[model samples]
Target: MKQISFKNKFGYMMGDVANGLTFGMSAGFLLAFYTDALGITAAAAGTLFLIARLWDAINDPMMGVLTDKMFRKRALKHKNQKVDKFKIYLLKGSWPVIVAAILMFFAPDGLNGTQKLIWAYATYIVWGMTYTFVNIPYGSLAAVMTQDPVERSSLAVARGIGGLIGNILPRLIVPLVLVQFTDELSKGYLIAMILFGVIGLVSYIISYYTVEENIVHQVSDVESTDKDGFVKSIGVLVKNRPFVAVSIASIAMLLGMMVNSAMAVYYFKDNLNALQLMSITGLTGLLPMLILAPIMSKVVKKFGVKRTVATSSLISSIIYGALFLLPSNAILYISVSFMAAIFMTIPHMLVWGMVSDCIDYNQYLCGKRQEGVIYGCYSFVRKMGQAFAGFFAGVGLSLIGYVPNAIQTSQVLWGIKFLTIGLPAFGMFIAFIAYQFIWNLTPEKQKEVVKSINM
Candidate 1:
């Protein structure tokens, strides 16, 4: 097997960069495009998000099991049994995902409201499916890349960095560019996604070439021989305290993050009266991530993922709570936002490593290698978080009486502030509680798990 190198690290980074370009864009800006650009009602847009993500959540596991089945079959067929299995799907699925991204943003002219809603549903479902097709495999690729806890931690950091870069680029560019096309909002998003798609696909291609699964371990056909494999594997994972805790906290984190992202533009535009601040926040918020991402492994090693994440979650909640209390003080808000963003970085860089550790725990308890299954289940929870965030944002906007392309009412602005700032704090608090009470996967414990897996 090949040794992991800078090339592999970069290739893996590119994979998330690719994902951030498309997935991140949708997460951050797509709701605005639906509510503001297309004049779709906030309630409808939220419902669409809920249904689509729920469907995608189901697909996440099915795809996970299906991929593992493919691997077992291929492994049995080959004498060499050394082929890189997981990274192979990066190129295969990215093109369709990229294409679906563009289409989801683009609806043909002269479509009535129901037709537009139908178009949104069809396009989004396909987009979500295509995303699942690529993401399950891509996410699973990291575990096989190396068995070293430090190296896996590094990979997670790389992914966080890449996702930040990918997400940030579009986050900065799309707002600054799209706001100018107020009259052509739909066209603006379509064109932005078109540009993002090419970049995302190219990034995936780079990743496919460079990222290698150096740890040549396999899940034997033992799983296949059992009639109740998927169920039994899932039950083990559910019972895994660390995995379950991580999943719960991850759900809260994703929910709050999505709400913050989806609502940032409105907060900036309506509350701050500075749409450009969106781009500015993206740049400033990225500082800690970029600076701290390289050293995240050391940080995780020093504090342990649970402590860092749990502590960061508490600190972040305070920051967000403070932001909510500050009203419309732009300077104080921005400064505090930067601090929260910095704390938020700790979890992004460490969570995957935690998930990796949980996978190890699964291997320890279940005595089977079911990385894809666990990761997929983890992803399913995160997606549900995203779904709820989407629904929450949409419904919150409606309740606030948010109107399209016009000055927002005072109540609407207050609601935006509440959704943007208050909810995130609550989410972080949940993370802190999860870490403190539920998850017990310490760094030392992880080392022991790895050692046991190897032996």
Candidate 2:
């Protein structure tokens, strides 16, 4: 076994931070932009978002297959030095993520309503599909980079720290940074999106150069997966009990996150009577992950990943439920908001690392390296959950008599309140249940799986 240097780990963490910044912006504010800034009705915007992302459920596995083939073909052509091929693929893959980030924010020249939705469909599909191309390979790079569990855990923490930076950038800074650009909301968001794309591109470039793959320690199983065989891989991966459980848990966790993301935007705008509170709430939501990340590994080690995630999620659910049950005061809101933030973030940081472990488990089970496909499966489900959240939020808003171009009624305000706080609270509760019962992988078991694979 070889060890990864601190320098390499730091570089990868910075890359993760940049990725977090870009993707975080989408989760943080994409729905707000669609409904309010871009002049699409909330329901229509929600449908479009769902449809566009559903396209990714189809596209992600293909990207995974393509990634596997790229590795296979490179192994053949390079023969002796196959590691360079994987590195080259990863370096080149970064650009698609950068481009997609820019395109998702683009509102074409002279488009309204139906036209805008069509434009959104086209660009958003490309963005989601291309992002998969980048992220699948990027996710797989970790297992290839180092075999040391301690090193991998450190990398996960650094990635969390980076994500905190990324989440903060668009949430906290964009509103302030884009103020000087234009009064038109769409234009401001467009500018912010472009700026984020550029920043992502620069940071991804640094990551490509600074982080090195631990090619020498890599286990070779040069079997190529068929791009047309997603259905088969789905069956195979689902049969792996741990992967199935983790996927379900991820869907529940992400549903909570995405739903709250949309609802929080609405809450701050309407009930709170503080439209700009998004920036403050967003900053507060982000800090816990940053502050707690350094110790997250130790915490998980002590408590174990499943228990830590389950507990945090349960706490978050209670806090979300209490947000409505408690008095609606400034101090109460602030306190619950911070607690909700911590709960939302801690589980997220740990779960992805856990998901990565599941990929390794699948490899051990099948005697094939299918990290890309497995990660794609996880991403596919999570994105589908996000789509569902968007749909639910839209439907909930419409049912609540959310009217466009008019003053909202007390009933509508009440609807908005439930959609934001109540819905996510339920999701968190469901997630807690899933984690407690479904996820059965303990740390010692995971170590055994890894050991069995290497042997």
Candidate 3:
């Protein structure tokens, strides 16, 4: 096996920078933007999210199959030269991603509710599709980069660090700036997304140029054109116990996190009556991840990713549950939120590594490596979780009688509290149960699988 250089890892890490800038922003703020800025009703915004992401169920897997077929053909065409199958999409899709990110926030100022809603649907769907085009390939690239479990974990850590920087910095900065322009929040979001989009584009270009895919590693055991057909490929994935377990855990974790993120602005602004505290809270939340990034790989190596994730989820659930009991003190709230954030980072850091492991396990069982399709299916479940979270946040708020920019009643406040803390805590508990009981990819099993593949 070849050693992956720091430069290769850095290049791979930068892809997540682009991911954090575009997809992270969408996850963090798109729903809020729809309701609060674009003047779309919460129910409508949630429905839009549901429709778009549900579409990803078909769209993501198809892109996976398409990319897999295209990569096989391209590699065969240029057999002698080093070919990075995924980078082509990264390069081609980068600008469209940025454009879509910008456009998703650009509802016309004079449009009525119906016009704005229509525009929202058009732009959001485009953004989701373009995001799929880029992200599925980018994610699958890690499995093919190298077959080392430790190296894959390291790559995931680097990606996690990149995501933290890309995601947290904007969370801290954009809100502070936007709070000043509360009356013109749509314009504020437009400006912020444009700036972030440019940053994301540049990051993608850097990743495209610096990253190298190992064609030999990709084709070591399987033929370049050894596709199992789409339906069978998906069947193989679904029947893989480890993949299914991880997919379910991912859905639970993301659904909780998305709902928490979607409802956070409200939690800080309305519940605490301190809009600026969002930045402070966000900054506090980021601290644990930064502190843990250096030691994350070592921890995973010792306990295994599944155990680490389960432990983290359990701890996070406890912390989230504690929030309901604590008095509404800003200092205490920030302190507890920081602790919860730290625990939450564990799963985020390990998830891609786990996904890569599932890809490996799939190859071990099925004798074919379909990185694109496997990742696409994984991404589809993740997007489904996001859609469900968005829908829950939207309709849940409506059910609770949440009124944007107005003084929220006690019922609405209680609902926000439940969505932010209770809902995610419940999600963490579910994830904990899934990983602890269902996922069985032990460290010994991982080594066995990898060694078998190489032999």
Candidate 4:
């Protein structure tokens, strides 16, 4: 077995750090930015998210094909040296990603509503495409890093830590900063996003330089034309029962997660009448992840990824459901939210490891490994869920007539409560159902798949 050093794992983790910085910012605040700061209606902001993501439905898979082709060409040219196909994209793609992230937030206040919407659409689509350029390749890199299941879990843990920092910091700090500058929320967002963009660029550069791709399996090595290879790759992924099952479950889970994150600001401000409590909520959520990081490998080894995810999903559903009945005090709300966060972190930490497992399973079933394509397809579905979540949250808010920075009416308050709590609880139940009924990859089966691939 090929050994992945600590340095390699740390570098791989940093890629996700960069990813989380951009992704976390968008997932947590983009809609709020549009509605509150940019003077767009909630429905319009949601439309922007949906339209950009619709384009990703095409752009993601094509990037996967392009990534695989690049890997094959690099291997042919530099036969003597190990060429890192994914990292090359990370290095080159980071520039546009950084620029686009800043542009997405830096819309000119001088533009009319229509002009601003156009700017939002153009910059956001560019952000999504460039993001795919970096993210799909980065997500695909783990399958080629090392084949050890336990090691993959450990890598996921490291990535989880990076993800937590990248995700939580912006959520916690940015909102707090914005509250201080309520008179100039837009300016505050611009400064914060630019700062995050710079940090993301630096992190990507470090990750590109630090991580080495040690394991290589060329998907394009088969004796077939490019078109034939691409079609076959898609067929393999489509026919993969485990991949399909996991994808369904992932979409549900991500939809809930994104909706919760996006609605949190509104929930805290409008319902709880405490905007600063978001920092506390973010901190409490971070605690469980910190406690679990050191021992997640052991947990996965004992419970298995699917079981862990299923169990966690069910627990989260229960907690969210319980929140509806609990006293509406900040203390109780924070406590229940903390408990739900604990359960939610398990799946978040294990998801990438499970993706690596699916890649291996695909290779086991088919004689070729199309990591880029497989990861791309998976990402495509995940992005779809994210788009719908944003749309739902935006539309849901609009339906209840949520007014930005105003004292919300009772009906709007109830709607915000339902969005923050009820919708995610339902999403969690759907995820649990998908995993219970659809996923069939057991621990023993995963071992067999890995062993067969190694042989």
Residues 1-455, candidate 3: write the lDDT tens digits.
67788998888888988988877678778878888888899999889889988996679988988887777777667776776678788799999989999999886868998999999999989999999999999998888788887888888888887887777766777788787788898888889888999899999999988887874534433353354577888778877878988888888888888898888788888898877878886677668777987898899888888889999999998998998677666667788878887898888887888898899898898878788889989998888898899899999989999998799998899888889888878888888988999888899998999999777
Rank by lDDT, descending? Answer: 1, 3, 4, 2
Top candidate on TM-score is: 1
Please, what are the lDDT tens digits per residue for candidate 2 over residues 339-370? 88788677677665766677777777776657
Pick the winner on lDDT between candidates 1 and 4: 1
Candidate 2 structure lDDT: 0.71
Clashes per model (N, Cα, C within 3 A)? 0, 2, 0, 0
Between candidates 2 and 3, which one is better according to TM-score?
A: 3
* Ten contiguous residues with the weakest lDDT in model 1: 218-227
Question: Please, what's the RMSD in Å of model 3?
Answer: 1.7
Q: Give the whole-model CA lDDT for all candidates, comma-separated.
A: 0.84, 0.71, 0.84, 0.83
| Candidate 3 lDDT trough over 10 residues, lowest sum | 217-226
Each candidate structure's TM-score, on Cα atoms with residue i matched to residue i, is 0.97, 0.91, 0.96, 0.96
lDDT of 4 by residue, 45-119 (tens): 888888788887678888888887777776777776656768888798888998888888885858899998998
Comparing 1 and 4 by TM-score, which wins?
1
Local distance difference test, candidate 1 = 0.84
